[model samples]
Target: MKKLIQFYLFIIFSIPCFSQSFSFEWTKQLSSTYFAEYIWEIATDNDGNIYGATDGGGIQTFLDTTFDVATSASSTVLFKINDAGERKWLRHITNSENGSIAVDSNKKVYSGGWFIGSSSLPPYTLTAGAGFGNSSYYTTLDSLGNFTSATKVFSGNSFLNSIAPVICNEAGDVAYIDNREFPSGFTYIQYHTLTKKNSGGTSWTKAFTTTDVVPLYIDPANNLYIKGAYTSAITVGGTTLTNSGGQDIYVAKLDGAGIYKWVKKIGGNHDEWLQSAATDADGNLYISGYFNSDSIDLDGIKLYAELTENNSFVAKINAAGNYEWAINLDSNAYHFAMNLLVDEDGNKVLITGRYTEEMTLGTDILTVTPDQNIYVARLDLSGNILSGMQITFPLSATIYDRKLISPESMLICGTFSGSVAFGDSTYTSAGGDDGFITKINFCELPATYYADIDNDGYGTPDTFTTACNMPIGYTNNSSDCDDSNNAINPLALESCNTIDDNCDGNIDEGLIIATITPASATSFCKGESGILNANTGVGFSYQWKKNGVNISGATSSSYTATKTGNYSVLITIPGSCNDISDETSVTVYNKPNATITNIDATNDLCFDTSIKLKTGNGVGFTFQWYKGATALAGATSNIYFATTSGNYKVKTTNSFGCFKMSTPYTIIKTCKLGESDSPNLQVLIIVLVALKCQQPIQLLKIVNFGNQSL
Candidate 1:
């Protein structure tokens, strides 16, 4: 018994023991030496260059495959990379102000946000002004790092927060979101503008507005979609939509003409806001945001049972303003949802936020944690958490935003203290709010499979194998039908003619099959037809039927149709069917003749209008209408018009006989008098009447007889 037990263990752990393993090594950092401060954002440009935004130190630019900084003196800069991820550039403005950046199709950058002062000078200084109380401004720049034009598009005492622009039309036009302060309170609205160039240079025209515009996205059709929260009444698509709770996320759709199509609000009684929105290649809209629910469970954590600031949730919304799925991220405490980025596959979403160390359970107990650590989590398209990874830096390090550099790479930017990894080397930031950038490259080593050859999970007594060739006892082992034939594997299924005989659920599935189906025998009015059908099973489906009745879905068979007017059936099936059987039909009826009759046109005999002739069952017959001796060249049987006062006749000929018929009809034309002739004709009639008077006519004077008539 002891020997048998040891032998069983060996068989279980043998497979995993031989599996290959790989290790990951960090690369060098890429940044400048000027005490990199808080890195707000990191992006790779079109030429594969790296660019990062600094909170106070401006922007840092990197070259191709180099960790050394190329340039590092851009103030209030927002870095951008093209869709190709090759080139990189920065939208820099002087005097450093808060703003958002967007790129158009032509590689032009449009930055809109609040600026401080005046809009003069080369770098455009923003000084104190009337609307300079943290008001918003919009500017445009060319691809060559030159300011094309700057415009103070919006101005107000209220803060213009969370601005996003999208290239909605091919004309390089953009639609954006802006929040304005009303007398009552602050209200978020959407605005759009188009650039036009006349003889006097370029100009902009204000298009339209929408309410609660936070997240803005434009589809390929130039349709604008916005999401945000509104308190008071706001008009969207010309209809006023109201929000119930204090703060709610509202989604509004607009047409290309700047007309609102529909507006939908999503949120509970508490504060809910959508942080990011994107459109897939299929034009499906996806949005991610935080929801404060009173009753919900997230990741096995209870939330919202009591009023607590820590209850926060993450959710995804579809294009139709419907929730795809919602996942509660924090149940005990408040977790802020910052930014959402989609990877290349577009099937996974990356959510970045800061979760406090404080926890609240049954009571409002706040743990005096030092700082909040930034957490980045990956989720599937369905809002299911795939992996939750957290990077905890010192309290001074503030991660502003992060983006996926590639499927396996990510770049994070924010404020950092001390020395932080940039590329290959560690870069120490200048204390007091410096910029910091970090790049993480993830290498997905090939999968290694370990089988329980010895029934043990440990590597002991187990053999490991590469995914390509799994060892025996593994799930993939069943793929090797003839283990002796090294070539006989899952990959070799195409070369074999047997059905996944390899147990891969694929039959000679990939192998081509030659099908041979004999042409179906033509059916006679009454006779036996010999039908021979054959197929090599290469790619074919055959079914033989007699008189439209399938012969039990038979692939190869013959049938006879004795009595029939027309008999036919189909053969070739799709997908697996390559050969098709010819459609055989036998006709037994001769052609029948049809004739027309009871034909009429216009009103009755009194009315002078075109008339028609009727015919009866006279097949293959031709007709000709005649007016007196001349035949109406354009006239045909069944209908003839009387152009003159005479009798109309129709002559028709068929295979049986020729027939002729006539109908009496009259034609009358109306005449009208001209203006000049009307006056003369009236005078002539009056003179003629005067001469035809039989009695001596006396000039009758107007007698004013009120009571008696004279």
Candidate 2:
């Protein structure tokens, strides 16, 4: 048996939010081709997959699969789809009203709602008390969309009932709020119960008194938070709070073990309603709603409502359940702050709701048509509006649920009449209001970026757009010649890939180098030159280098090597593509010395006498003796004997085939006078052949001293 508890009721208000630069990635429409379906709520799993719970159902087609929903007015439809809008499965819960759906960290989904008479969820069924009796039931399914189990929580004699969304934390703990009724004496008494099912399948129930208390959220630590409006005094966990105005807003917390933590009440002299609440990773709480009170007190801080109609307000509370700050959004007409979500770090908060006419927050004004306007705004934890945007529909539209996939991305679901634009495409409803889910990205002052399809840091200018901060698969450098290949970028190195790896116009230009003409080492004698030519190609430029340094005036295909060093040529193509050929080592040797000397030391001799002459240092050399300018016959040896007088010279050629000429040597025709021939000096014919003398010639004036005749 379940224990009865008091109930607290809170009224929900609608308000407009702020504005900012918002871009939609995709939009999905859900409804029958001929019938209308209103998407009441949406939830996401850890994989970013979405689950929707709706009523007033119809059929829908996603991808290649078709889902034909039941036509019952009370039939509840539950469908699952991936983050990219690809449908997975759809289920029909017959004889049941709409419900709220949620997913745990493990992707397990839970949903709870009311059903009339006899309702069934496949193999599981629930029976009411009698005629028109309504019962609250909770059912769970695995991530694959298979029903696991169902439990009947409460049954009512009448259909008048209220239920909150089923929420689960990462630890698999689930909680929800439901109205339980029992007969006291005559009529049945209505009571609100808070039910918690732990991961281990343990269950606990607690009740609240005289107010509309709905289970708002459950944090990762399994802490449960409930919010509603209370009049006069309200008590929780032995602590009591007295209202400061007609109806005050209150939020209470319970630990995973069902122990009360604290309760916070916020109000003014007039009525106030709390529409939505959310918590950050640090357990900090942020709430938003509308207050008609001229001024509302949040802790010791005071915030005054704007305009004569209901004004929207958003506030923050620390982990200790203490108020931090509160601010009001101004609008001349009725406005209500509907939904609020905060980042885990508590740095940003997003609020979404409906507004009429115009609404302003800080310096931003969200002006919409006279009909219901949907506004979204982002604020810092300090309660300052960073940016905002407004969405308008020609007829009527409402955003029922929103989930923050990250600080920069969100998923929103709702129902709208008429047509709505998503990105560059427009989608119209099928007859009446149609359910829709859209994914939007929040960006900070976007800039144009090109698509780097190859992810090479360089992109193609052919595909570009203004989008979020350095979006994935995009870059600011648009200099890639081949966007399909990562190796072909502006900064890539030239290789043998045949294509222009460095984005240069020429393909494999520098890589194809012409080898030096004489591929092997070459040698030449001193004072001689060697001609070296490079293999030529069309449009090819050349620069010759010596000893690894560029040689002046050596820019042709052929170069003259006049000195000894390592030589190479730079073969180039236009557009800075070039390569240096392998070095050709050159060696130059000195020609053998080519001087001639007299061997016998006798240049003046009589007839029939001869002298010998030789050239200097004759190793590895070919020598030739010359008379005047004519080559002497048989003078090719390194040594020569001169029998006649004439100007004589020697020419030498080294092993390297280089030649050098020596100075001329001369032998004069002369006679040496003997003692017996000196008497008749005037008519004597002196024969001085083969004579060796210290002095060769002398005047014969001694005739009178040797004979006495003159």
Cα deviation at 233, candidate 1, in Å, is 5.9
Worst 10 residues of 1 by lDDT: 4-13
Cα lDDT of candidate 1 equals 0.46
- Going through the candidates in the order shown, the clash numbers are 79, 22
* Over 4 Å off, model 2: 1-19, 56-58, 62-64, 72-74, 116-129, 160-163, 180-190, 231-246, 280-282, 299-301, 329-335, 344-395, 449-465, 469-710
Best by TM-score, which number? 2
lDDT of 2 at 40: 67
The lDDT of each candidate is 0.46, 0.73
Candidate of highest lDDT: 2
- For model 1, residues 1-710, the per-residue Cα lDDT tens digits are 00000000000000111111211112222244442433443434334444443323323433233222223332355554443334354444544344445454555656654445553325665443464244455666666667776666555554332233322333455665444433334553444333222112433333334333443565666666666566655665566656556565566676556556666665455566666655555555555555665653322333352444534455555556555566665465566666665543546666666667553322223343454454556666766765554444446555555555444445555555566543224555443345545544333344455443432222221445543322334442333444444444555545444445343666555344333343554332223333444443334455655455665645543344344423333444344423334445543332222333335554243344444444443566677766666778876655554544455556665543434444534343332222334332321112123366687668733322232222
Weakest 10 consecutive residues of candidate 2 by summed lDDT: 1-10
Q: Measured by TM-score, how close is model 1 to the native structure?
A: 0.44
What value does the lDDT take at residue 166 in candidate 1?
A: 22
